[model samples]
Structure formats: structure tokens, C-alpha cells
Target: MKLTPIGPAALVLALSAATLSACGGGGGGGGAGGTDAPADYVDGATFTLGLSSDPGNLDPLMGAGSALFAVTQFAYDPLVSVDGKTGEIGSQLATDWTVDDTTVSLTLADDITCADGADLTATDVADSLNFVADPENQSPFLGTFLPVGAKAKGDDATGTVTLTLASPSPFVLNGLGSLPIVCPSGMDDRSSLAKATSGTGPYELTEAAPGDHYTYTLREGYTWGPGGAGTDQKGLPAQVVVKVVENETTAANLLLSGGLNAAQIAGPDGDRLEKSGLSAAETTGLVGEQWYNHADGRVTSDPDVRMALTQALDLSELADVVTSGRGGPATTLAVNEPVACPGDSVSGALPAHDPDAAASLLDAAGWQEGGDGVRTKDGQRLEVTFLYQNNLGSSGDAAAELAVQQWKAIGVDATAKSQNETTLTGTIFGAGDWDVAWVSLNVGSPDQLVPFLSGPAAPDGTNFSAIDDDDYQAGVDQAMGMTGTDSCDTWLDAEALLVQKADIVPFANNTVRTFAKDAEFETPGQLVPLSIRMVAK
Candidate 1:
């Protein structure tokens, strides 16, 4: 699944960094206008945020959900940082970088130090890269962010870290920006990484309550932040408290009562929060995406069945209902800002809603409807488990039920199973019991989606759906061969191949918002912790 802001799952692929730059530059422009410098500032103040779900595992390499990613951003500093507004590559841990042919050499910032008071070294940086680059480690980030067979070598004398790629990667810098660097201690004992913190980031994990909340204390003299944000920035919260509330109504009530500084809410609660004069930073992303399991034993494994399933529902109506009329028709798989290939891939690619066509297709596939309007073949009922995340607000549940009903109408018994993020991740990557899943995996680039689309299936790799389309692979190969915006046409074409073939279905695109009360921060995709500040309360 593509790494996107935590929300309802949407079946979509990501764009390549080169494709994103080629499309319209990084989509980091302003949203809702409350992120401007605060007129009055309070130092050493605390800021509390309400989250809908627990960020399961804190390990960036093992965690799959966006909430875990968001939390990681607070404790670990990436080698590079991408500007959300301008799409420009900025310095974070690395001061400067040069891309020559297939190799990317970075000049590490010499002055930065980890939260443990250890000097950040080039060797430490190289070790982290090398660790993820090794597939034997089974990090989800392998092949997705770090190029396969990539070698990292560091020189302490000059503080230089050179990464030699086995193959050409157009968005190497973008991937590095998303990869959070782990300290030597965190790297040595990875289990400790799940609950502890160590890095060159601005904050350190001060308290950890797991499912309840997490507290972070700002580090003094820390200057290494995304876009060069310093520790002394005006109104910068000295302490950040992340509270997991899970309920939208409860979160909204907390926002209104000033018990919470900021919270991400959608549907009716979001409407109510916005109407109350709260400043919301709206981040556009994919929602209500459907992914059919292409594993051998699954009913959706059949191409005809996948196509018939796609043709059964009215995506237009589904999008409206799923987002509670707050979203538009999906246009691209790369819904996150700094979208590399932004175009209408969902238009002519997805099958139109036609119940008759769906029924006919199923009939052609030798699935006969029984007395109860359920299809059966060879004494087996056409029943598939439909899994969705329970954390995805009220409309997400409604959308799942509606899809189940629609599938029932088409004689396919789709069981709606709502699982929490942790359960869903484990099930998809561990047990592989699901047939169809509602998961939104929106990364910044299409290269990131390579593993999910074509590589090994779950239990081995992230291609949980077991999708293996040769035509799509051919398109990806052509696109990857090109550099920068030069690969735009081929990238879009590759995305179209997936959509046209019904390998993944992206149904809704919602402009999700995070309501802020007595606080200000940039919610480009997720909350930028460095940009957060506590206003007068």
C-alpha cells in the first residue's frame, strides 16, 4: 500500500518523484491559510493533538500505516526533506547532494547530533541505508524507498555518504526524504525502536503510553529540521502530546472544549468543526479504494471476476456517499501533494457502473445465480471477505456496507469486515485471509508503488493482492528507464493499465482536513510537527 495520510483506505498507486516534478512540481501550496507565522508566541508551551487511531508500531521499516509514519517524522530526521509547497528538495540531515548517473552522493551535515547526545556520523547514516537496502531484513521500505542492491558507503573524514544504485532510480531523493534515519542504538536493537526514540530530529520521545498517547520534548540547540526549521522558531511548542481518541464526536467535542489543540476529522464532525470557526488544513488524498486479492485461492483471482466486480457499482454515487458529499471523483492514484503524475487516470480506465454487464460477465465466467440470488460454481458460493479499516470515520463504514449490498445485488456475497489498522496490516501482510480490502496506500511517487503492483505477494512482499500483470510491468519498465518529467506519459499509461485491468479500484478523492484550535501547523499530507505551535488559550 502506498504511504499516505491516515484515512479511509483507497485503492490507488503512487507517482514517481520524477513524474511528480514533471506533472506540476510538488503540490505543496497553502491550504486553509492558518499556517502563517503567529503574531503572538509562547515558548516552552505544550500542544496536544487528537488522533483517531494508535500508530501501531513506531518502527518506520516495519510499520505500514500513515499514522505510524506521521509519528516517526517527529522523532527521526530524514537524510533529505522535500518542500511541500514548492516541491523543491531541501536539506535535512544532509547538507548537500549530487546525483551522477545512477549514484547519489550526499554530504552529511557535520554538526547534527542524535537525541541521545551522540554525534551523528556518516557511518551511522550508511549503516541505516545499507540495512534497509538488504531485502533479507524484510523491511517494507526495501525496494519501495531504498533501491534494491543499492550500496551505501560513508567516509567519516569528510562526512560523506555515497549511495551506489544497482539500477536507475529517478526519485532517489524523494524516497530518501520519506525514509526516516535511525540512530545506531535504534538500529542495533530494532525491537527498542517500536517504543523508544533516537535521532537528529527536533523532538525526543519523552513518554510512551502506547495506545493512549505519546509525549515528545523539544531538544535544545537542535537546528536540523525539514526546510531548515530551528528550535528557536517563534511559537514552536516545547512539548507535543499526541492523544489517541478514536471517536470523531469525542474528538470534535474536545476541539470545541479546547481540550485538544488539533484533530483530523471528516464527514459530519468535520463539517461541524469547520463551521465553528476552527482553522482546518485540508489535504487531498484518495479514499474508498477497492483492492481484490489476486491470490490463487481467492475468487477475485479470476480476471473476469475482477472486471465484473468493478462494473457492479456506481463509483460516482459511491464517492459521494463515502465522503459524505465532501469529495470528488478520483483522478489519480497519486493523490498526495507533490503528486508526480497528476492526471485523470480514473476516467476512461475504470469500468463504468453496469449491473447488467456485471451479471452477464459473471454468467459468462460460469457462475450461475442460485435461488437466493447468490452465485455458485462447483458447489462453492461466490463469497469474498471485504476488509476495511474501522478508524476511517462513519462514511467509510457506510461505503463498505453499500459496496457489500451492491455486490450482493450482482450475486457476489461480499462480507464487510471492519478491522483496526494493526489487525488489517497483520492480516494483509501476515495471514493473507482477506479477498478484497479497502486500504488507501498513497505514496508521493509511482516508483514507490512498484512493490505493491508487481513484486512478490504478502508473507514475502507487499503485493498483498498478488497482482502480476505483464502489460503493466512492461509500461513500468519503459517509464523507469526515462528520467524526470520525461517519464510522465509512460507513468500515466502504466497507471491506466492497472485501472483498466481492474487490478485496483480508486473510487473517491477527498480533501481531508485537520481542525486546529489554539494551534497552528502545516498539514501538507500529515501534521508537520516542526511547524506546530501553541497559540494563546
Candidate 2:
């Protein structure tokens, strides 16, 4: 597939780190279910959802983050949508579509119109795709969702938009389903998109209060939702308020007091929320994954050092600590449900905990242990600056502390640093000042991860860790040739190459829970715009 070559200047602020704590959740309950709303649909009700952090730069194309992705769904619509339960491709803005090796042609619905009452043309849709496809635009979704080097053409008379890809992508339709298309107004004046909505979704942004909250008013006569779902249904909220609540506990308290309609509680607060009899929607996501910087000059660049560090800690204990005993061992890099390849690639692929073995590896690498129990090679101490997201709450902090103690016992000087989502993204993808990171990048398709794993290193590309495993790349090359599930076996084997060599250590998978009091909704990754329903208490 074609790849967007992002320069150093753009890399610093382009890629936003995915929040592990707020990975996936919606206003409904018990797995992905929340579509079954009560018979009474409370009209004129305001649905309040809590976010752990502010979704900076509201422009959908330029910004990326779980918060921003979640918020964008309220005011923007994708070309298509995949059913969270059946995995079936459904219509959103595009009424129908035909996909093949190098081309995808989508037929737009005639009735679709922008929030401003302007008719949405096929040209608008094509323009949105082409904007992201251009490298100069620096859209983070380029390689992840929209194929790089892709081009689009539109015929307004026939209401059809055609896209030609540079290479054959097995999961092209699924990726397109996640990309939000901007209306002509937003595309014309990109600056207005920073704090406004100009899409053809079921709602329009009425107010944006950066760090406080974002309010969206429901748009009447919205009938072109996923699978022809309409906003005229009973119980649909008249307004949506996304309140910024950084603390999980505070969010839970709000949910209990009925002050908020929904909030995702990943920490200890989740237990109480489950018993409170509120509706919920749960999505399994990677909660604890470790990555070593393979860039030159970093101590973790050495293969021996990476393997030694992997064997230094009891991953099971770390997993429990990180997830607060609620999660289990990770099975695959793609942890979310409706996973294209449903199989384990992590078990028996990593080294078991053995401090003695770890120390031996260090000795073999010519690192001598000093009087202070720190290893030094060529007059340089083996010091590591580890980073983890602070949104993982107290459990994440505890897990980092435990990992540090374990590394110290092996004569490695490791320090744990906690950063919020925005700072952490910049540190890993921009500053490149970290040795190891406990962060997660969630995606449904294995192809979506290739850009972040194998391509050019940061400052030049999205491969933040600078991973350069030839065997993994070979496997991916082979897998890319096949189509759909036919390539799953090869994809799983490719993930194994990374694990067997200790390039990445994925340890925990948590059932991310989002609780709702007076509302019900579903989230494939973010809340489905059409699945939301307001209820009277």
C-alpha cells in the first residue's frame, strides 16, 4: 500500500496517542448491546457524556485521539459503517457501494444535506477523501484509514464518488467506515472546523468550550443514518453534551447522581457502576502493551537489551496490576471484538520471567554491574526513561512502579514517567525522548497497524518506535497479497514475529466499560450516532 511520508515538523503535532483508559465505550450496556431502548423515548432530553480529556483541534481530518474520534461522530458521518455485532457493512452517507482490487465506487443518497441545509454533493465527499490522501495536508488518518496516494473523482449528476487506490487493500471498506467526511463549508474554510461542525450527520455543534464541554443540537429530518436509521425515532436526545471530566471517580459520581447520562469508568469505579443497575456498553481493548525504542543511541535499541528487559518482569502480575485484576492476558494486537482474525498470537511467544536469565543477557552484552547495582557499558549507565499514560488511573501508576522495581532488581536503572494523552503522543511520536512506553494503539484490522509498525521511523513517518524487523515485514508483505480472512493466518504469524523477538510486549486486555443512567447507546470504537436513545428515569 502507498504510505504518506510525514516530515519532522508535521509529526510533532499530527498523531495523537490513543487513550487506553478511554479506549472504547458507549451509553449502552453488557458487551456491545445498547440498541434496545425503553419503549418511552424522552424527547427534548439532553444526553450528557463524560470525556476524560479535552478533544483538542476539533477538525476531524487533522486531529486524532479516542476523545476526538468519539466527539466527531456526533456532528460528522462516515461514507459507510460496520455493524458492531454482525460485522456487516452498512450505509451512512453513501447509500450503496461496489469495491474491487483498485477501485471503490459509492452511490450517495439523494436526500442527504449538510447541517447548514445545503445539499451534500458527490464532489464534497470526493474532496474530503482527496484532502486526506494528499501528503501536504498532513492528515493522521492518511495511512491508517485512507490509503496514501489514493485519488477520487465525483459525478454530481449521478451522485457517485469513485476512489482509486494505489494498491489492493483487503480491509479498505472497513477503514473507510471510520473516516469522517467534511462538508463543503468545512473543507472550504478549514479554520472554522477547529470549533464548529459542518457535516451531514444527525447533529450540529452549537457550542465548543475547549476544556469544559462541547454541545451539539440534534438536526431535524436526519434520515440517512447507518442502515437507513433516522433521528426521528422516539427517545432520541434533542441535545448532546460532552463534558470534560478528567477523573474517573468524579465521572462515576456524576453518573450515580444522575448529573451525567454516560461515562467510561476503567478503574476501580467500574465495579460500583456495574452494580448500580445502569445501562452499559463494553468493548475489549489493549490496556497494557509495551514498546521499546529501536532508534539508535537508545539503550533499548540493542536486541539483547530488549529481550533481557522482557524477561525481567512477571507479565501476569504486571497485567493484573495495570488492569486492577479485571483483565486477563492479551491474545492478539487487535483486541477489539468483531476482530477480522480471531486467534491468539501472544501466548508462548514471549520470554518467561527469569531475573537470572535477564542478568546473564546483560553480562553477555558486556554491561558490567556496579556497586550501586546499576549496569554500565563503555562508561555509560544503562538508564531508561519509561513512559505511560496517566489516564490509566491509580492502577496504571502502580503498574509502572512495579515494573521499575523489577527492572532495578536486574541492575537496570529504569524511571517511570506519567503523561496525559496529548503530551504522551508528542513525546513518543514527536519528541522521541522515551526508551519504553506502556501505551496501546487500537484498530480492528491488522493492515491498519502496518504503517505504525514497519514503515519509516518518526520525524519521517509514523513508526515511533523505529521498529525494523525484516521477518515481520516479510510476513506482512505476504499477507498483503491475500484478501479478507484468507490472509488472517499470515497476519497472525506476522504479529508473532514482533512478539517472539520482543519488539513489542502486549500483556493485558481489558473490557472497557461505559455506563449510562438516562441514555442508551453503542460504540464500535466511539458512540454510534444512530444508536443513542434518551430515556426517562
Candidate 3:
């Protein structure tokens, strides 16, 4: 699974940081419009939700980012659905499932159908999983969600799909909950899904006007929603319009004006939105995470440099600034609520703010501060390039500026650069041109993070930063042996190893609020289709 860029909507690779932002929060009805009680549910109304950026690709397998993940949820159905509140597994495409160590078997629902009115079979589901599992396909999900070397076989007559894993996966079922199953038609002609959608979901993409909006029309007779829910409910929306409004204030304005049914406001505008008494679906997620490029020739490759850079900044202050004082100290990389492993792996594990210690670490590493204050080592100036997501709004920009100043004060010439979700994903995962970045890869399961943290460095694999921590790897190996929450202790220990070594920095976690105007819905990383209910203005 590709790392979701952090944006207005939380991304889980299972959703990406960008896509996960919209996916956070548990099930909830829309808050009343300035009253004590929520508005009455209405039938056949249009629901418009604002997106911070346009989800460029509609292909379920090929795309990477929050927008694509959010939009795809409209047209794709995963094998199962995870309850946002209880962390319970619920059925969607698959009616029942059984897992034993490395093997997983699922019984498909007979009535499932694709948007094109084609009958969805067990074969189509297997093909979609196989397509992503095949390394040659270079799917971002190759090792993350679907275990590496996983193979699936389908028996249509029995309506069953059996998967054999290369190794024991602890949260295999949870991973499957986020893996969108592509229909046979989209699988055959993958290019057709670039702007169109073909999947066994309740909504189908009917209009695509990129950068402005993408419209999805509801499918009648759609009964196979999460938890075996149906679309025949009284308040279900007839249409869902995902409007691309990058500005948080603009989105808030539109929500207040009833032009949008929901919009995630993470900036100062959230204050007024709360005051307006608009209903909101909220979930806490890692909003401020920092990563270093540990590849050869990078200044951050040196452990001492990485430590010093981390020590240079006051993380508490940075977290507050980045979140506009709305967030708290990050306790774990898995901040998505109802997380598979719930614990505080980050609190006391990281190096604290100590500028003098930072300077000494740099000095010990042979980077001496010159008369100009910028450090120099072996005739090379210690200049650093930093990148962060632009969707974080002005607060994010301020945080980046503050970090640069803090680094400069410690004799490191650091320049902060902001990039949008799409460009940043390409830079970090494809080009590998960045030195450091503020990106968060949100997922419910700890196992989903393995491929990105340890495996081959990108272009080759999703380990974009090229982290090679033996302790982390060892713990992962140990944790993978255990099943479910039985492995939480080991997983938290492994996460601490990464933090203790300064491999990754998860500083702040915020309650990501997706405010609703005339509709109420659940976003367990992405909007739950069946949870959406149109309401009176």
C-alpha cells in the first residue's frame, strides 16, 4: 500500500496520508445546524463533500494518494469492512472468512454485482488480489496490505477465494478491509479506470470534471454494504459530489452555505465551524510526522546527524504550531482510532529538545560550524532540503518555517519546501530527491507499515527512506508470529526502536474533524458508503 499523504482527510495505506484524512472518525450522525437535535433525514438528496485536492486516478490498484483513495471508496468494495468504533470485522463483498496462520479463506456474497451490471464472482476478486500481489505489477500495496508472495485461488462454483500467505500475517483480515476489489472489466482494460470506475460498490462515477468535481450516482438494489447493510434506507443520498476545493476557508464557507454536505477543516477555520454547530465525524490521526532519507550520500544517512536534527527542534512547540494548538503529542504511528495495536510507543522514546546537545552531536560528527554559522564537514557545507505537504494550510507552513529556523540556529542550513500531495508522493516514492519530509502513512494495522519501513528502497520498493533497523526488523519478525492484539506489545516495542533510533519522528496527533452540513456519515479513514444519510438543511 502506498503511503497516504497527510492532508485535510487522513490517509490509510489501507488509506494513504492524503486519503486517510478523509477516512478517519467512527460512525456518527451529522450534528444539528445550530440546534440541540440533528436535522431530520431526507430522501434522494444530493450530497456534496469537499476534498482538499482532486483524486487524479480512478483505478483502484494503480493510484496512490488520499484523493484517489477517498474517491475510489465510492466505486470499490473491499472484501470486508472494519467497524470504525469497535475495530470489529464486518462483511462486504465477502460474507464470511476464516484465517489460520498464513492461510485465509473467504466466502463471497452471491448477489454482489459491478457498476456495469456484471455479476462479481470469486474469480474477479482473486484476480484483483493477484494483480496487486504480483511484484511485476509494482503495486504500492504489494507487500504492505497484501503480504509479499501471497497467492489467491478462486472457485466460482463454491463462491470461495482461498489465499496462501508467504508468511504468518497478524492483521491480515484488517488489511483486506481496505483493499478495494476491482471488477473484471476494469481489470481487463485497466486504462479504462483512469477517469472512470468499475467496481462492486454502492456508488458509480457518472461525472468527472477534474480539479472541480467528480460525481457518483447511487446504485439501486445495492444491498451488500458494510455489515450487510443495504441502500434502501430512507435517507440515502441519490448522488455524491466530491468537490475539489483546496482552500479550507472556502470549503467551510461552502459547508455553511449548504453548498457542501461535508468538508474536513484542519486549520483555524475549524474553530468557527465548531461554533456553527455543524455535525462532525471525528478521528484522531498522526498529522505531524517527520522522516529522513537514510540512503547513501544523504546528510541524514549518518545516525548522529539524524539525531542532532531531531534534537534541534522543540517538538512540543512544533506539534502545537503544526496543529494550530488543536492536537496533542503523538503516542503512536498508528493513530487511526480503533487501531490494531493501541499503545504509546512515541511519548518518551524520542530524543528531547536540546540545541546544545544537537550542536555537540554535529561537532562530534566532524561538522564544524564556520564563521558564517553554517556547519561544514570535509569541505562540504551541511545544507539540508526539507519538504512538507501543502495541504496542511498556513499552520503547516508556519511549522515548516519554524523548523527551518530551529535547524539554522543549530548551525545547519535547512530550507523548507512545500509540495502538494501528488508531487510530494512522486518526489518521495519515485524520484527520491528529498532529504527530509513531513509525511504520515496512516493504517490501522502495524503489519501494514512493514513494507514501507524496512523493504527495498523506492523505485525498488516502498521503503522510501531506506530505513535499515535490525532491532525493528527483529521485532517485526517476532510480532508477525503472534496473531491480533496478542502481538501489540511486540509491535509497540518495534515502533519504539524506530523512534529511539530517530528513523522516524511522529510528533503530533490531532482529532481530524470532517464537518457535515446536511449529511451525516462515518469515515473510518474513508467515508463508509452505507453510513451516508442525506438530511434536511
User: How close is every model to the real structure, measured as TM-score?
Assistant: 0.93, 0.92, 0.94
Model 1 per-residue lDDT tens digits across residues 79-195: 988877666899989989998878899998768888998898999999999988887787778767787779999999999999999778877888888778888888889998888
65 Cα displacement, candidate 2 (Å): 1.2
Clashes of each: 16, 4, 28
Q: Which stretches in model 2 have alpha-carbon errors above 4 Å? A: 1-39
Candidate 3, overall lDDT?
Answer: 0.80
**lDDT digits (tens) for residues 34-113 of candidate 3:** 22323466778898988777777667776557778788888889999887778888898999999987889999987788
**Runs in model 3 lying further than 4 Å from the true structure:** 1-39
Which lDDT values do the candidates have, in the order given? Answer: 0.76, 0.78, 0.80
Candidate 2 backbone collisions, by pair: 28-280, 28-281, 29-280, 41-235
The CA lDDT at 370 in model 3 is: 92
Model 1 ranges off by over 4 Å: 1-39
The per-residue C-alpha lDDT of model 1 at residue 227 equals 54
